[model samples]
Target chain A: MTKQDTRPRPKAGPAEPDRPQRRKAAAAYPYAFYLPAGIVYVVIFLIPTVMAFYFSLTRWTLFDSTFVGLENFADFFAEQNLSIGFRNTLVYAVLTSGLKVVLGMLLGVLLTSRLRLRGFLRSVVFFPVLVSTVAVGITFSVLLKPDTGLVDRALALVGVSGHDWLGDATTALLSVALVDVWKGVGLATVIYIAGILSIPPDYYQAVEVDGGTAWHRFRHVTLPLSRPATYSVIILSFIGGLRSFDLIWTMTRGGPGFTSDVIASIIYKQYQAGFYGLSTAGNVMLFLVVSAIVIPLSWFLGRREIA
Target chain B: MRTFRRVTAEVVALVVAGVVFLIPFSFMLLTAVKDSVQAAELDFSWPTSWPIVANIAEVVSARDYVLLRAYLNTTVLTVGSVAITVVFAAMAAFVLQRRAGRIGALANFLVLSGLIIPPAIVPTIWLLQALGLFKTMPGLILVEVAFGLSFAVLLFRAFIAGIPRELDEAAMIDGCTGLSLFFRVIFPLLRPVTITVILTMSVTVFNDFVNPLYFLPGDENATVQVTLYNFQSQYSTEWNLLFMDIVLITIPPLLAFVFFNRKIVAGMTAGAVKG
Candidate 1:
């Protein structure tokens, strides 16, 4: 009986239908579906990236070129403001991302709670995300002007005198970083809200059953579980802050004699100065700095996520 | 009593956040209608007389109606880029999800890296020059689509995983093949993700500054953000007109967000969380 069953199963498996149709469809589709996007990505993104590496080694204007090995990199590093730009970039990125994480999580928790006018409030917070960054920079620059700006005037009402917000060397970078946080925290909050919502209710219920108060529940459940969102918020904002140019360019233009120059603005200044090779090197360096920080951070978070 | 305290606390928090967020925008709007004198004062005092229509007209007519031209150019750029990104990303996503192989895995890595790595602008300009697309509208369009494709493809791939393979097989059994099968059967089912991509990408491309600054430099090809340069010069103090320009350029995307607020939030968060 066993031998007869095995013989019949082999025949049925060999003669099973639909395999030919599936194979035909597979053959027809091939991998050409990836062609359109693949072509665009390769031409516009991938090739430029590969060329960036090569071009950074060559001293080239728009119409001329000469190979200069690592001289551009040396010159980029040796520039008078390079060290300040590097330092400012780190400070700006850290300040913005750190504030964004804390503020975003706070707002997210509040908005996700049983609050009044939650939807309207969320919209209000997120409205800035839609505004153009350049516009935001300009508006804030106007508002934050030393004395005549609305911000200072409003401060005067409360008996606090306003100083140069974006003009003074001391406050320029920090001021821009604060605006960055304001414009970006909305996104961070949205992400955190999504993360908080995704947490299963059972965890909270379990905490309650164990006599955990709201604080305790949040401390033990929400905070730990929202790790993924926090990771993303930090990485996204950090990268954004590192690559920040438009706001700085529009707001300060590395004002007060190069006090607020981040790496990107520095690169743009080089490009404006016709140091194409040096700017390309700066771009590569910025790329390296971002990836070096973000990749490992992501890996660490990912491993923790699985664990 | 505890519940009352909690409620009051929540209300306080909400109001504070609302004020912080809304004040900048409200001030922008207020200044938009103010006269040049009132704008120079830069105080919170309400405009004594609203000249909103006049301000709009002036901004519209400034520099040979450059703002209107910018609006047209931006609309073209946004629509064209979003359309290309959606179609190409959807097709690529469908194949990447359905067809698992070595090449697909490499493609996946490339897409992911595109999200992390910064675009090298100088070389990109060079390549565009080589292709005779530098300083051209079509070049800028291609740049937008390329930069946006990674996020769209990632979102589509996540959404597509929930769709069972049996649907493809079932469609194929009914004589649907290749483009017909995708367009007829599968594409219709991807409407939610499609809307998400469209709305999100449209807002992003429309609001983008750097790409247009680098790739499309001519005044004739100015996007809305680029037109900010018109109002702002090295030593000009046209705060009123500049604020008016801000209000005008901001209206379309701002209105889009207000109307589709829920979908935009959902779509944006969905991409981030899933990614």
Candidate 2:
């Protein structure tokens, strides 16, 4: 670790002993530092967000757009698979986020044990996260291909019939959710590692001194201290699930009759089908849906942080 | 003894965990090597003959070598996007962290919101069209930079915060100009975090499927992930070729993680842990 000298930077102006104007300006230096990022945020993100709402009311292709006044949204709702996509998005978000946090923490604790080859194990666990989403989806697409997949072969070893995981409407969404959990659990583990490491070992020692069991220590000390990590995992994973496209697109393309079509995939399908106005509406709905969930959650989390 | 039991339990747990993680990668590797029949069977067995060369040839030669073209496009996109993101983000973060006020607070919130909100794609397309940047590499590059800058700025802001303001002042005292103050005085000290930003940004831009799929449409500008469509038709998907495509696409980011995983983790966790 590099040792940092914590000296404050010397001011530019001559030894003018603490003028309010200079102090104000100097104190505002940080904002000056932040300006370029501010421009980027406004232009790229905020502008787009504001325009999405505006355009969602309009019927438009790439170049020419006209004010249609919520007709697009109505069309989106009126569409056959839209409702299903909406339901799938919510369910996928909840399941993937819930599983990721639980599995991530468990895996994190297991990996952090006083085991051999700890570094190697950590790397292994995190490897999936580094793979491209499309690649993971493609790999699993083959691996879960009912008849010839490795998973089916493994099932056959136990005298069980294997079914098409991605092609089956019943299993497709859940299968994607599981693969998401598999890929993303590493991130949650990373968070947990940082969280766990930060907790003073003395807490564990004190618990032990009090005749507390391992489970007891974990329940009272480890879990509470790791709340921040849990919160992070939930929020990040939920948002990811809501916006997930690549994996689902590659695997089944929301196939077997739109069984696994999350909102994002539905929107992409609209784009693919050349329903430009409808797809744009779907995009708006996705933004709105994510915002509706995330904002309140962020506020609640922020309040919790304050508490 | 209790100690012996604890150690044994820990070892067993570790081995089980390792197997869970390792098996998938093993599956990927074996699938890449196996012939069509072996692949379809999902046989965990060793390949009778290494079809690695043949598979690579097929994937590369598919769709007029679009996958190879996609790889080149990805490289260009990643490099261009990262360079823009790092430079612009560092500059932005420098100012934001240095200057403090209501404006700063508002700017900070906007950037944070960028981190949370899913981008509205349709409007973005319209905006691009209005700007006449649609279906262009530079347009996609700009879009990538725009999205990427928020996270980079956040990282850079936190890292820059730790650097005392004294250095900026001292440099100013020595008659350094605006650009010099940043380039010569402050920028050099940002090596660790800059490397983190670069590594993370590069991986993200390279692995990105959506942005390129949307912004850089057409075979001429198609990126690696989008090019995987070559293996898929209306009816059937070429599993062997698709897996090979997977191998190719997965390699760069995997290698990146192998080298810079620590930095990437540290960078990501910096704000949360430190706060």
Candidate 3:
């Protein structure tokens, strides 16, 4: 009459009669399997990250060094473009991620709405994600020219004037961020599309039963249910915007006087100027900035999942 | 289900996509064929005469065929890093999922950090110089693999979790040893996820611009993206040639998307869509 009598017998091959036999079986999946990847990841990614902190305090060429304490950090903060880079990084991340969330959700809803050309539209949107960022950046730089570019020409046809988009400090960062949205919003859209498609139909049916219109369905069902997708889009795009380099580099070169200079671009400029310690310091600052913004943001977004 | 709204949405999406996506590519094609003067204008106009062949020659021959060399270098970097990533990530993922311990948890954190944390580029270059790997293709390839590993490992780990534990036991009972158990039995079952990892990693490593720009400097190791960037200043006013370079370098990714469209979407959206 014991509870053990109700249990089914375990299969012979996997069922262990002794602890020793189970241990032996576990040996088949060795811990050594982690070594190869661990070696490469540590040597190439993690070690350098640890070394960045040490090297940032030293005025050294790659080969030789003399410790300079906090000079590099002070110089980095005082650098003419550093503040702009910091401001631009946050602005770029916010602007890009915001646009991506709104636009991606809308497009996601559109694509999942049982449209005729869903497949075609999805392909068209996501294809840009595969294109070269440098190529796209350059193309947009050309397109954003004041008078002769296609963007301005089209705007003129619509009775709107086009300004010097990339040449002006005021518009340069905004312009680059917009182009980024164009290239990247595809990724966000796909994520959103997947999230929307995975939603259970029962909720929508419940809305219908309650005489919910499309707007009501979206507001009540889709909006609340798609929080996971929204979270993913914001985090991924925000991080991407923070680390952004090639697009800004190719488009503006942090130019028109560093208005569009992001942290990554700032680091590159320091390195290019032979300020090795300063560049390494900039790298540390970027890491800190990314962590400060992202860690809290992700925690805030993720806390609701537990409930 | 609503045909009217669907059609309207479809038309609007089409127009927006056409203008945003289509016109720029069309401009690239058009500009690539135009004479230098018209190309420099950077306007949307039919070429008075299609100097497509000359443009191609000038672009391909520019800087003593640097673009062709870039294509070769990019292929090596992409293929090399992607292959290493698939094997290493799959192996590591296999262990990470099967073994539940502090080691596994720590490893998982590091892998995840690789995704969130930006690389310290200057320190990395210094380390590479110290190790005699700077300005070398192998160095850059390893860098790419390191960066690509985290995502691949996570994807493979997720996929691996779905694979039953019984498979490992069955194989082990058949006298399969440690590595062989993973390679012969577990690895083959990973084809679907493997393909996904391969496609996405290839696209990422191939289209990468900054890594090669920073790590693998010098014309000897110019990647496709670097070649395009270099062509920018070199051919500043040569719009036809510049666009030609852009067109040339864009093909591999374009071809990949065209053929493996579904797989790419599934692989990319796999993480974001899942809770």
Q: Which candidate comes out best when scored by lDDT?
A: 3
DockQ of each: 0.72, 0.54, 0.77
Whole-model alpha-carbon lDDT for candidate 3: 0.89
In the range B76-178, model 2's lDDT, one tens digit per residue, is 8999989878887888788778776677787788777777778878678778877889899988988898888878988998889999877777776687756
Error of 2 at B217 (Å): 1.1
- Candidate 1 chain A lDDT trough over 10 residues, lowest sum: A1-10
Error of 1 at A305 (Å): 0.6
Task: By TM-score, rank the candidates, best first.
Answer: 3, 1, 2
Per-residue CA lDDT of model 3 for A3-30, tens digit only, reads: 3455665666754455555466458767
Report candidate 2's interface RMSD in Å.
Answer: 2.6
**Would you estimate the TM-scores of all the predictions?**
0.94, 0.91, 0.95
Question: On DockQ, who's better, 2 or 3?
Answer: 3
| Model 2 lDDT per residue over A217-271, tens place | 8899989888888778777777788998888888788878987888898877877
**Interface root-mean-square deviation, candidate 3:** 1.2
For candidate 1, list the clashing residue pairs, or say none. Answer: none
Better of 2 and 3 by lDDT: 3
Q: How good is model 2 by TM-score?
A: 0.91
* Tens digits of per-residue lDDT for model 1, B1-275: 98998889877886797568878888889888998777878777799988889888888888898888999999999999999999999998988888776888998999888888889989899899999999998999999999999999988999889989888877777888778878887789999989989999999999999999899998999999989855777215667788888888888888988789888988778766644
- How many clashes in each candidate? 0, 20, 0
Candidate lDDT values, in order: 0.86, 0.79, 0.89
- Which ranges of candidate 3 are over 4 A from the true structure? A1-22, B1-6
